[model samples]
Target: MKPFPVATALTIAGSDSGGGAGIQADLRTFSFHRVHGTSAVTAITAQNTRGVTRVDLLPPESVTAQVDAVASDMRVDAVKVGMLAQRPLIEAVADQLARVSLGPIVVDPVMVSRAGSQLIDNEAVEALRSRMLPLAAILTPNRHEAKLLAGMDIQTLEDMREAARRIHALGSRVVLVKGGGMPGALRGTDVWFDGTRMETLSVAPVDTPNTHGTGCTLSAAIAARLALGAPPLEAVRLAKEYVTSALRYPLAVGHGNGPIGHFFPLIHD
Candidate 1:
């Protein structure tokens, strides 16, 4: 028999034609951590550093086919769950997740955009909260997403902690309330809660307009480390550091907002 793979990770996300976010960024992140990556593409997006122009969603059956094909053939050590744009897709993915024994599921709730836009309908959001959140081993949500999940505003660090607490009650084993949208020094401070313990994760904010794939990168990094056998909290901490370091060297790729360099460690200029 041949030697086994180092580790394997699966990304259930959309496709970004820009190659800066979604499955593209996720696969890049897993590669950076020396983990093998597989993917189930839920939607194909026409987008760039500027913004999304169009999106063509795949049928839930097609998404499930990809997921099943991977789960059946490979040993998925961890999973990074991203945008399921509708209630049907959310419920479908949730069902597939229940059937698979894939390791840790790091869920980046892509319910709200950085610009404060609701990406999904109320029913989709409800499906995510009711069906998907409970399946998450780690739920990473930005400020707006945290507010929506917790039903409160997150204006301070304590508010973030409380949001973590409230979202934890929603059934995710752990909740990470990201502070990337927070003001002042609070930015880049993420709160992690696992029902019993609450820990604050603060990294110096890297100011850059090239933050296109940050949310995707962070969650993918966490899943990569988890695939490599890191504990939940440690994985999150390391993922945040990875994202922070990546942001220090943003990729000036497009006309509008650029993207964070996924391979920044190899970038010398």
Candidate 2:
């Protein structure tokens, strides 16, 4: 068989040894969307479907070199950025992104893991806000991350909206505040706040314990869509739908929370 043509994407994020989230999830999501995915690993995580045990951040120069090598050679159409562990690393990414001028950047503000591990430190949040958000075409943050960024509790749908607004004001072009953690809701609800408008998207929540990489999957799927020239709203819409289906058919792989079935279509079809 002839090799598939390269439809490239760049993921600047951490590596998950368990292959469920972080760089692993991002690459799988991109490939599922028919794009060739490249990566610049920001950190190495000792984790599984259960949770993250430890994380060692890559040095700033190493991170920068990986990005530069890919950007210089590949026809990268979109970029997805995940966990940057410290201030210098965040700034380094920001600086390299500026140099490369990659657009339709998807920034996932990964704070705590699904297993309740702290991915980003308190000091790094400000750097992410000040240095990275402005470069993103869209910022994807779960409810807790939105609350931390907005410096307020998001207990209601109204508060979610308010949080999105504040996040938009913090230099992101658009904010998609994921409401998975919101109270009184087991449903998959997320709100997208563009500068002048707000939209709510919801799906019937799947009953499963395999949601470890949903956030990373969503952002990478969006980047893949954008690489194929989809608009922002459409990109998000398709990505959400894709994630919903993936979650509906999760891989029960580990002792604790497992991975979503990234190849669900192949299994089902």
Candidate 3:
């Protein structure tokens, strides 16, 4: 007998050897959401919980080829994009996206690492903002990334609102400025805007140092929800809830910062 049907979500991102971020985290989140996961790796990183030590980018053609091979055979219901490390990769991914009409693309603009290190160059940032942002159905940028894209520091809630508005003007159907990195009580607050109405999603903060893949996990969950036929607002809400629950029980494996419990439902204490 044929297997039962399930929604499929594709991730176009870098590979994380540590299984905590990038494509690894995205695919893991997709599994948790019960969506069939597919991926096109743009770069590979020698990284673990400690940090990224080295990075190797695949050729632009190779990236596009992976996307092509998947699109030619499989039915991709939704897509999540992350960590295009350079301008060429950004342009290539943007070109591929423009060529095919994929379902809700969640752009998780992976510019800066959680530890405040700039992962991509200035030119790549411009490329992402100009080329990739325009194609995003939902653009998920944390405080630092929103600042970079919107050209302002995001410290207060008002800053997040303004940043979301500025990013929305860049052509995304929706913009979510995550305030997880905000100081004190503002943490875990996210501002969502879609040109006209703006709202804040406030969740009680999960205090854990093992939040390495939070960003990737959130975007992937959103894509999975989109694949499962949720509207944009509902998808974001579900994704936020998933991330918060995962953060409640983090995995205690690595030496440094660890991963959230993507399998929390199965292994919670």
Give the winner by lDDT: 1
True-vs-predicted CA distance for residue 108, candidate 2, Å: 0.2
TM-score of each: 0.98, 0.95, 0.98
Ranking by lDDT: 1, 3, 2
Residue pairs in steric clash, candidate 3? none
Error of 2 at 174 (Å): 0.8
Q: List the lowest-lDDT window of 10 residues for candidate 2.
A: 111-120
The Cα error of candidate 2 at residue 200, in Å, is 0.6
Off by over 4 Å in 3: none
Q: Where in model 1 is the C-alpha error above 4 Å?
A: 1-4
Q: State the lDDT of candidate 1 residue by residue for 1-269, as single tens digits.
A: 99865899999999999989999999999999999999999999999988999999999999999999999998999999999999999999999999888898999999999778999999999999999999999999999999999999889999999999999999999999999999999988999999999999999998788899999999999999999999999999999999999899888788988889899979956
lDDT of 3: 0.92
Model 3 poorest 10 in a row by lDDT: 112-121
How far residue 29's Cα lies from its native spot in candidate 2, in Å, is 0.6
